[model samples]
Target: MSNPLRLVLFDVDGTLVDSQGSIVSAMTASFSALSLDAPSRDAILSIVGLSLPQAMQNLAPQQSVANQTRLVDEYKQAYHAQRLAQGAASSPLYPGARDVLEELHAQPETLLGVATGKSQRGLDALVEAHGLERFFITRQVADHHPSKPHPSMIQAALSETGVAEQHAVMIGDTRFDMDMAAAAGIASIGVSWGYHDVSALNSATAVIEDFAQLSPALAQLWDK
Candidate 1:
């Protein structure tokens, strides 16, 4: 008999790709354009899994709503410009990311998806640049939902793939991802290399230090 379908949703930035350089550079440019001091790298990275607007709010709480909106626009423009200049190099996949993704894609019972804070255009660029367009069954982005820590994105992915909460899992590098999965009533696996500290992923069902450990983690998760 065939196994039940399973959904695995991933977070993009720190989880799959190492885009910290681009994120920080764009954030700096955005603040510079407004003649404002950019937040520290730690501050910026702390909000990596949240939507851009929410990120801006966290980074610039002292700014008026109008200024925060301007920062968001400026950051988008700067990030897009950098992406055009750097192409695939702008957000290169982490070591072994593609291989693990391919392995998961090869499983007939597994359906892959993305639940990220990135905009649709940003996600499309990454997928196209990396030739990953064929791997994802559902792409949920911040443009259509509330930011990380909210269940909207994962819920949308589940709805689209017809996967039950118990049969789905979220893999990310942040507490936001873990919290979101919990809110959605799905399991979560946190990666140690992402922006968030490993200690912050206390809610994760399992925390893996490398991509090679992912399959085993997934196996264990489903075995429960």
Candidate 2:
């Protein structure tokens, strides 16, 4: 019988890149453009894994859709501009992020994919800036699916890669990622260095402190 495929799906923002500084700056600029007070940093971090519209809603739950749409549009522009100006320094990879991804991609039995709340354009720029395109086969993005915690992105990734829920694991730093993976019936692992509260990632199979710890955790999951 053919071997079952093992897939590792990664989240972009907090898990792979430390883009929080830039994210907060862009958001501040976005709100500034509208002459509004931006949500606090903690509030922004809390919504880091959601799609922009959903995030805006969480930030201002009582606001009208048109208002949220305006925020979303302004935020996108501000983020794009910040990225362009920052160039390659926009978002550095988290410590050992490249090493882990490289190590896993080297394993022929393992397939790598990405499920992110980032827009396709944003995700593309991020991967390209870091030369990470070759490591991923299927990339599920907010531009292509509903916001995370909805499971559409993970579901689409699993279907596209022909990897069963049991054979796939999601790696991210947020509870949203965990909830999404759970909603899709896939196991998940969390990273500590992301913007979210790592303690809140109770749904993860394991919470890893570094990339070096990831391989072992993944092995443990596969064994279960």
Candidate 3:
């Protein structure tokens, strides 16, 4: 008999790729293009796992909706320009990320997917640059979902992969990811080296400090 298939979904930014430099730079440029003062680095990172519209709303609540729309446009343009300039160097994977992903991908009974706040264009660029297009079977992006904490992305991934909630896990670096998993009735694993503070990950089923701990963490989670 064959082992049952299990799906593991990952968040792109912060979790897999450390795109903080590009994120911060693009955000600053977006605000600057509109002659607006950008939010502080901490404030910007706080919304890292949200869709751009929701992120803009959070960062500039007092701004008119029109300005928020403009901010999103500017951000997309600036981020794309930066990506074109730097390619894969713009967002390097965290230490051991590729090795861990490779190990997971090699498992016959395991399937990998992505549930990210990034748009399809952005996600595509990152995946191509990193040569990770073959690793993930499903790619859920903010372009087609309601963003993290909404369960839309997770639900879609589960539906697409035909993986039961109990047999799937969401791995990310923010409460939004934890909350999304909880909403989707799946387990969540949080990483400490991401944008959110460790305390913010209290809702996660498991928390690990480095990529090396991921496999064990998954084992422990599934053992429950």
Instruction: Give the per-residue lDDT digits (tens) of candidate 1, residues 75-154.
Output: 99999999999999999999999999999999999999999999999999999999999999999999999988989999
For model 2, how does the per-residue alpha-carbon lDDT over 93-211 read when each residue is reduced to its tens digit?
98898999989999887999999999999999988999997999999999878888999988888888898999999999999999999999999999998988878898988899989
Q: After the best TM-score superposition of candidate 1, give how far the Cα of residue 72 lies from its true spot, in angstroms.
A: 0.2
- What would the TM-score be for candidate 1 when compared with the true structure? 0.99
Error of 2 at 86 (Å): 1.1
Model 2 residue 202 CA deviation in Å: 1.0
Runs off by more than 4 Å, candidate 1? none
Compared with the true structure, all predictions reach lDDT values of: 0.97, 0.91, 0.95
Q: Order of candidates by TM-score, top first?
A: 1, 3, 2
Error of 3 at 165 (Å): 0.3
Off by over 4 Å in 2: 1-3
lDDT (Cα, tens digit) per residue for candidate 3, span 1-224:
87678999999999999999999999999999999999999999999999999999999999999999999999999999999999999999999999999999999999999999999999999999999999999999999989789999999999999999999999999999999999999999999999999999999998999999999998887777
Which candidate's lDDT is highest? Answer: 1
- Supply the global lDDT for candidate 2: 0.91
Worst 10 residues of 3 by lDDT: 215-224
